[model samples]
Target: MPLPLPPLFAAWRQSLRAGYAWKSLRGDLSAGLTVGIIAIPLAMALAIAVGVAPQHGLYTVLVAAPLIALCGGSRFNVSGPTAAFVVILLPITQQFGLGGLLLCTLMAGLILIALGLLRAGRLIEFIPYPVTLGFTAGIGIVIATLQLKDLFGLSLAAQPHNYVEQLSLLLHSLPSLQVGDSLVAVVCLAVLVLWPRWVPRVPGHLAALAVGAGLALLLERAGLPVATLGERFSYHLDGIEYPGIPPFLPSLAWPWQLSGADGQPLQLSFELIRQLLAPAFAIAMLGAIESLLCAVVADGMTGSKHDPNGELIGQGIGNLVAPFFGGITATAAIARSAANVRAGACSPLAAIIHAGVVLIAILYLAPLFSYLPMAALAALLLIVAWNMSEARHVQHTLRIAPRSDVLVLLTCLILTVLFDMVLAVGVGLLLAAGLFIKRMSDLTDTAALPKHFHHALSDLPEHVLVYAIRGPLFFGAAEKALSVLRRLSPGVQVVIVDISAVPLLDMTALAALANVLRDYRAQGVGLVLSGPTAQVRLQLRRAGIQRVDGQLAYVRDLPQARVKALRWAGGSKT
Candidate 1:
């Protein structure tokens, strides 16, 4: 089918046409403000975690939230840079620089848009459940590892891209930890952990960040070592200085205009495009999977069915356009989406209002937010990573799951932490698929020929034999079915294969069947195939397997097959 534009968002349209009352408007406004407040610190934290400026995170939120609200399928879903992308985005950023990262994001956006339009959005479900859990948990561990340096103020000579190497570097720099910075982190982490229990009025994360910032400022005034965003960002990112905020609104800019950390100009060429293709594809798949998963969670909470394809288009467009303003890959954040629902959001209007809140903060409160300590942000991300890891779930899975499933889950986890996410996901999916195939083939069974159904061949000698094939005749099960036929008795004169229970036959299975027929013909035994389905019969006919040399014939049923086999044995069908 040809690709089509995603259908209009009827949910949003309906809300406008219906009598949306002020009661609902108040709920949406309150929800929007609540989501926006929590999002401010998270957006900053996630951006830093991804090794980018805090503004980039806010920029993504500011642009993507509104775009998604206007075009998204889910009313409550909040889309932006999420914790899940931190590991995946880092490698691309290091290899390609900011320009290449943005370009890669744009390409990913285009790919996602194409997938949504093609209605291939449903393919995300095919990713095995274990694979999703493994990689997600693996990512959580990686996120926690990445934050340790900031959490303890352990500045390494360079941050290694590989997890093992990074861990080693972190270990070596352990002696370099500053107590002042550690205390700041402790304050923030404690606030985040205890605030919910003690004081539920203000968002715990925000309160934690504020306390951490105050302590850092006091440490700075007392001449103690404490790193702040102001100290860190003023000299970061290929000479683009930042102390507070850019103070400039987002505007159109070519991604290739930026340079690498080493000052190498990023040239947009076929070679660069080729280099980023794999990363771009990773971004697209991850974004689509995350967004849809968030939408599903929102649906469960709100009893609303979101248009998956429409939401995909909204996500795609957001990622595609946000890059032009120096934003990274954007997608629906599950935690934030869930929060939007819990905050009493009634419609997409809440998301739009949330975006407006972020825009206002960026314009007015950027300087104040810049006072937030990196240590606090690190603590916040550590908490997020802990939640995302789902360690309890993973532990439970490792215990109760089948050995093969455990193997797959562990393989994906090990690969993600020990290597690149691209390799991890690719190998995880392949391993899961192989395991599925093995299980399918195991279910395929063959049984002895039934005598009651062989009454039509009563006149035949007792040496005549029958065999029944069960389950799908796809590649996975074909060899098992053929193995059974190989064990036939030596005195067999006619072989009747009952395929009445078989529903499918691919080329490989057809070839296997042809091989069985050839072996039987060589041994001077007649072969009869019973009950080829319409689709299977079409394939067999196309393969020229119809009655040939009085040995092979496609019969309607077991009785017909018996009669055909007897006739073939008498050399009548020839």
Candidate 2:
């Protein structure tokens, strides 16, 4: 039977049992705390980047991290808001508002759970590498562009719905950029970029936040026109509030309320849900890709395996539950997982603890976040966008990949930027598959050759012939093999087929060979196959071709095959 759990999970279990050392517990605890510290600032930044209040991002980490750790199969896998989802979710939030976005996330979670239970996790590995690279590069570009507003503090009449229009608006607003925001962003970017080199071990993002917030406070006291988090956002109890869950979960209808422009209940439509389907699919695809990629990376660092399906199920459940509490889409975070592993995380417990830390921050420290400068968050994400781009990999793919593969990479990249991720991946995969089939077909060849006995001019020879077969006979080569045999010289007596060179034959090839043999027999040519490989012999035998006497032969070598062909040719004359 196939392995019960996914390979990643199986590996994880093996690692846990094999490498369980007491010394590692302290390291795990230390690492978990370190990762939690780094995640706090990032979680807030990511939530804002997605156009939601910073608290929602914290909520995602708080809700998702524990759920995934408890139910997931990876020991060090950390689940929370990620940069990749920002591009996919932002548009959904813009179009559908928080409710529709939450509903989409909920649907995506259910889809993931279904996929996990169906054992479809391994299928994620089959996603083309070029597709991943392309979409990721595109997402990085989108994220960087999205941060421009805060990065420069541009004042615009409205945010553009599309990337191009956004850029156009940003360029037009360059003169109106807030000097205070610009200075804060520049300083924050500098700190994030340089602090790691100096501090070496301290959480760089935390340092950037401290420095940026301090600078903003000092600037405001100095009478500078800086925009604080408080200036940008206000916690209006009436704006967007988390709904209270009853003691028992209420029915969908009881809780299904859509907000109107005037704060009254508005009628909901099925069309709104239908429009969200594409974006939801995009979220699910990206979540699956990023989470699995993070798991694979963690496996490499920890020398442990993760359960991809279980992880998917966990992610789905987390995402499904998170939006109800004002959370956006969430996934495995590569940076946080690396930090957790590097800090010596011992088990999934560390991730659970990390979630607890985030919860504590949310419950107590949320008000202090109002002092955070928007530019600092933008600077943080700018660094994130740069790291996420994987420019080195993109350059490498372009330089080293084959022309066809490069074409696929470029196609996906352009489509992801010009249209959306769904179109890019769908088209890129189809094109790549088509190109792969064409390449395979080009490598296959088939031809017909005369039997060895037919070369001899004999007195008793009236009609005699032999044919040779070679090469891998698979689906790509089957048609050529059969077509060549059909055009063989007519008026032949005995036909011996040389199969000494055939290394493999699939069912399609076998069927093609059988059909050609049947056609040859109809023309009165006695058919025989000689020198079949051990595998080929077994296949022919199992296919009942061995039972067809005088129609097939499995010889030990070419000499025996030649002798049999001579006797058959002589018999035809007699």
In lDDT terms, which candidate is top? 1
What lDDT score belongs to each candidate, Candidate 1 first?
Answer: 0.83, 0.76
Candidate 2 — which pairs collide? 8-306, 9-306, 9-307, 12-305, 28-344, 450-466, 451-466
Off-target runs (Cα >4 Å) in candidate 2 are 1-24, 221-223, 237-273, 447-475, 490-574
Per residue, candidate 2 scores C-alpha lDDT tens digits across 1-574 of 8656532344346447867677766776787788888888899889888776677678788777777777776778888999988877777667666666677887788887777778888999988898889888887888888888888888887968777888899999999898888899999999999998999699899999999999988888888777767667666444663321111111232112544223444355687667777788778888888888999999999777778888888888888887667667889999899988888787877787788777667666767777888889899999999888888999999999999989998898888777777888899899888888678666666545533334432333435445566677788777876576677565666655677778888999888878876776677566667778899889988877763446444566655555565676665332
Which ten contiguous residues of candidate 2 have the minimum total lDDT? 242-251
Tell me model 2's lDDT, rounded to 2 decimals: 0.76
lDDT of 1: 0.83
> After superposition on all CA atoms, how large is the RMSD of candidate 1?
2.9
42-124, model 1: which lDDT tens digit per residue?
88888888777778888888887788778877788888889999888887777777777788889999998888788876888
Residue 70 accuracy (lDDT) in model 1:
83
Query: What is the lDDT for 19 in model 1?
Result: 56
